[model samples]
Target: MLMGLLWASAAAAEAPSMPGHPEGPMAISSRSMTVKNLDHRIIFDRDVVVKKGDMDLQADRVEVILTAPPNEAAGHALSALPGAGGAMLAEDNVERIEANGRVKVVQGGKTATADQAVYHNADETIVLTGRPETWEDGYRIQGSRITILLKEQRSVVEESRVVIYPDEGSASGGP
Candidate 1:
């Protein structure tokens, strides 16, 4: 029963959305799962993959932490038994997610690879660490850490190196 609830919650996690990508439902699969209701945490281990629309996330393990609604206390009856209240309880409670061990994320024409990635729901930001690299539109950025602000459609690479490719039609020499 606990497993069933955990699966349902994971399935209901909102799909991440980028500027041009469609917002679809997230689908996640893994070899094993564990749910800690008391701690409001869920873990997916061993070849975890999450997909939604044009985005895909792959990692060895993924952890989800749910946040209590404002004015609501933690470990409430509704939260403890997420399945009891149907999809609403499961979907909106997610606070943050962490993907660890060879984390890779692809969205639209962009791809990001890292040893770990964390997504914060409240701020709509994703932070990648451990030799993070991102490639998009013939450009690539590599750094120790990468922060993507989904709401603002901005990315910041720290301790970074960048490569940009000129357009095919652009003049190579001064014209």
Candidate 2:
């Protein structure tokens, strides 16, 4: 179920890998899972947790929106078709993911928290809203909204307040 979410980035990564690489496998658990094949969506409700590589995501509810038609089966099934990385449809299978209610993402040294988060596969972008805040190393930023474009390698925070801790050497006035 989870493998179909980011298989394209892993399969089509000839140059280099993207953030949250689906290199291995993803583990997801929730109070319950609802598979709506007719709607081409999967919903995980209540205390949902998702982990992939060094990234961990937690939310009260998560919805994986698939691009497949109504006839399409569970998204993971598309991963087996032949094509680029066993069919790029695997990529289309998961068009986007929406997380709501206390959404938090932790990857390596970085962490982000918000009330809602949406990840768009085609654009490789993640948008966080509802008092979003992000932190890494000694830097912290809180904003009304945060847009992270992984493909473009940039982040934009609106109405942001940032705090950057000075380096020890710099703080000590070292040459």
Candidate 3:
């Protein structure tokens, strides 16, 4: 009886953990799912789809990487589940993010698609490449090679041929 009770308690304690769900976002793969925890309250899922107000983020895998401002008060310090650290969220400190397989991020009428993507919390940006494409604000950009310039809030494409889809009533250049 004691053994059974102990097992039950352990299960209960781990129920909300990222591994426990495996059904959450961190481990989702169209069949299985996992949730990556960030600061306890903030959790992101792998192979997940998220909608935030006017933005949408979708990916095959996800992670949480955040850093508390040193100047911030201790009470505001955020902590993640024990043993659930070290997952790189981005090129730097990232927090509760998703990636894997194919990643797509849409924000403020801009859409970006890539084979891999990483969201950075410290700089509030996402870096994606592997044939990335970005469309937004009256312009559409695509390239066999691309980089999302989060800091400049623009996309830089390399070795890419750009074709601006002409609108109606626009005259074609004379031959």
Candidate 4:
């Protein structure tokens, strides 16, 4: 009787697991995923596979990397958990999160995209390359390179120039 009960308990514990909560801390797949960032309100819908410590998350597309005010202070110092504040979803055609496509970022009516992008949550910055374009607060800026500096709350464009695209004429009246 005791032996029978032990076997049943073991079998029950062997049930399938869920994403981000797998048995070991890792998940893998050939599909796409969507990831979202709560803090920034940023969403990434593309092919992506991510690993956090011992856990693995994979999908054809992913949407994530949203940001919000830190519960404590502005620019408060703390180490961040890898792939902690987002969700990954699966879909058809393994979505590539890193390269060879357009990446869109939306913040406060501003939209920006680039061929490639890297989001560093620890530094609170995003780097976009390859003909990056940005539309923010009725201003549009395009350049060969763009660096979003969240620390100072500004976007810096390198090469070419920064142009403002507004519904009306350029609001700053600079040209």
Maximum-TM-score candidate: 2
lDDT of 4 by residue, 101-153 (tens): 54454322334556666545445445668776654443455667665544444
The C-alpha stretches of model 3 lying farther than 4 A from their native spots are 1-47, 68-98, 136-139, 168-175
Can you rank all candidates by lDDT, best first?
A: 2, 1, 3, 4
Q: What Cα-based lDDT does every candidate model obtain?
A: 0.58, 0.60, 0.39, 0.37
Weakest 10 consecutive residues, lDDT, candidate 4? Answer: 1-10
TM-score of 3: 0.49
Q: Model 1, which residues run further than 4 Å from truth?
A: 1-21, 68-91, 166-175
Q: Is candidate 2 or candidate 3 better by TM-score?
A: 2
What is the TM-score of each predicted model, taking all chains together? 0.70, 0.72, 0.49, 0.41
List, residue by residue over 1-175, the lDDT tens digit for candidate 1: 0010000001111223335323555556777766676777767788887765667788999887777532243434132323221111243566877899998776555567788888877777778898887655545567777776666555666676765557622221210
Candidate that would win on lDDT: 2
**Root-mean-square deviation of Cα positions for candidate 2 versus the true structure, in angstroms:** 9.8
Per-model root-mean-square deviation over C-alphas: 11.1, 9.8, 18.1, 21.5
- lDDT per residue, candidate 2, 4-46, as tens digits? 1111111111213225455545555777776677888777788
Instruction: Assess the local accuracy of residue 98 in candidate 4 as a C-alpha lDDT between 0 and 100.
Output: 37
**Which candidate do you rate higher for lDDT, 2 or 3?**
2
Stretches off by above 4 angstroms in model 2 are 1-22, 69-92, 167-175
